[model samples]
Target: MPIYIAIFCVLPLLAGLIPEYLVCRFTRRKWWKVLPPLAVAAITALVTAGRLSVWESDVSPVTQLLFVPGVPAAFALLGTLLGWRLWKRLWGPRVVKDRRGG
Candidate 1:
């Protein structure tokens, strides 16, 4: 169960975080911010749906609908948010010191 959570949730979160951070940091385009979570959501949904169709699953439908894909997708969005923050910290305008001591 824990392993499943790690594979499904944490992996996607990292997958979303690293690339999004790098791209946004370099490109600094607001539009590029949308890609990671969207990709993660689509991939996670498809993988979860595939798992359900192929196996004798024990998880409930509500759990399937809500948690299986939802948690990972949410993590992905979170990664995007964190990535944006990191990019801002790295590349955003710096406050220059006043040498005249005004």
Candidate 2:
């Protein structure tokens, strides 16, 4: 599989944890609130770097410009942002209410 595709497939599993971990380490906020953006940024950077590496040997400047790094980076950034937003919308405000009367 292409590196970008492989990265995309694997990112949800790996990148999903990034924001939570970062929040836990840096601040005390819960995972749901902070994870998505961090995950997306990490995935974008990784994808961009991978694309650059894959296209570094191309001879044509136009091919290099079109296929090298920018497009994948942009896609990864947008994908990550969308993924984060979806995750937030689905599970962002999950406060557990106490059932017993005080």
Candidate 3:
């Protein structure tokens, strides 16, 4: 149970990081901007996969619709929003002073 919880928690983070790293390494675009959507997508994918794999034998419609995707989707949204806030705080704006002729 703990292992399952751990896997659920970590998989989305890993999935989020993969796209961030790829964008940073391969393209000129800022990786931070892409993280939120990617994180959400990744979390969704992970949750869906986990549900299908773990409960395929004993699946029911309610479990299929609610438990399998709902929690992770919520987590993904929260995580992405948090990540975006952090990214903004960390990398947003710049202070520059005007240099005028003396």
Candidate 4:
């Protein structure tokens, strides 16, 4: 039970942190920063849905590996949002000062 919780809940959230930081750090545009992670989440949801819809007795190894539970994606979304907030706080837009006394 504990292991299941850790794998499904804790690990994904932690896994998500890096991608978000990298995205925020590398991407200059606001849209660019957000698009990648959302695309990941969307892809995961689609895959999960497709797998669930098709009833199969023999699941492929690839499919099994790719079979990500929805919880992880949700947690990851939360993690990305947190990362964005942190980035905004740390390296967000700054107010430029006038060269001469205004």
What would the per-residue lDDT of candidate 2 be over residues 1-102, giving only the tens digit for each residue? 777765644454344444444444455456544455555567556756665654556566556655434455455455555655665666568888899996
Relative to the true structure, how large is the alpha-carbon lDDT of every model?
0.76, 0.54, 0.59, 0.72
Between candidates 1 and 2, the one scoring higher on lDDT is 1
Question: For model 2, which pairs clash?
Answer: none
Per-prediction TM-score: 0.68, 0.37, 0.47, 0.63
lDDT of 1 by residue, 44-85 (tens): 778687757534556566676667667877887778778778
Kindly report which residue stretches of model 2 are placed more than 4 angstroms away from their true locations once superposed: 1-58, 94-102
Full-model lDDT, candidate 1: 0.76
Residue 51's lDDT in candidate 3: 68
Best by TM-score: 1
**Candidate maximizing lDDT:** 1
Which RMSD values do the candidates have, in order? 3.6, 7.4, 6.1, 6.7
Model 3 spans with C-alpha error above 4 angstroms? 17-58, 94-102
Worst 10-residue lDDT window for candidate 2 reads 16-25
Better lDDT candidate (1, 4): 1
**Model 4 Cα lDDT, one tens digit per residue, 22-51:** 789888777877675777677677777776
Model 1 regions more than 4 Å off: 44-59, 96-101
Off by over 4 Å in 4: 54-68, 93-102
Q: Which candidate, 2 or 4, has the higher TM-score?
A: 4
Q: How accurate is candidate 4 locally (lDDT)?
A: 0.72
Candidate 4: the clashing residue pairs are none
> Quick one: ranking by lDDT, best first?
1, 4, 3, 2
- Model 3 lDDT per residue over 1-102, tens place: 887665555555454544444444455566555765765777578767776655556657566756557655665555555655555566668787889875
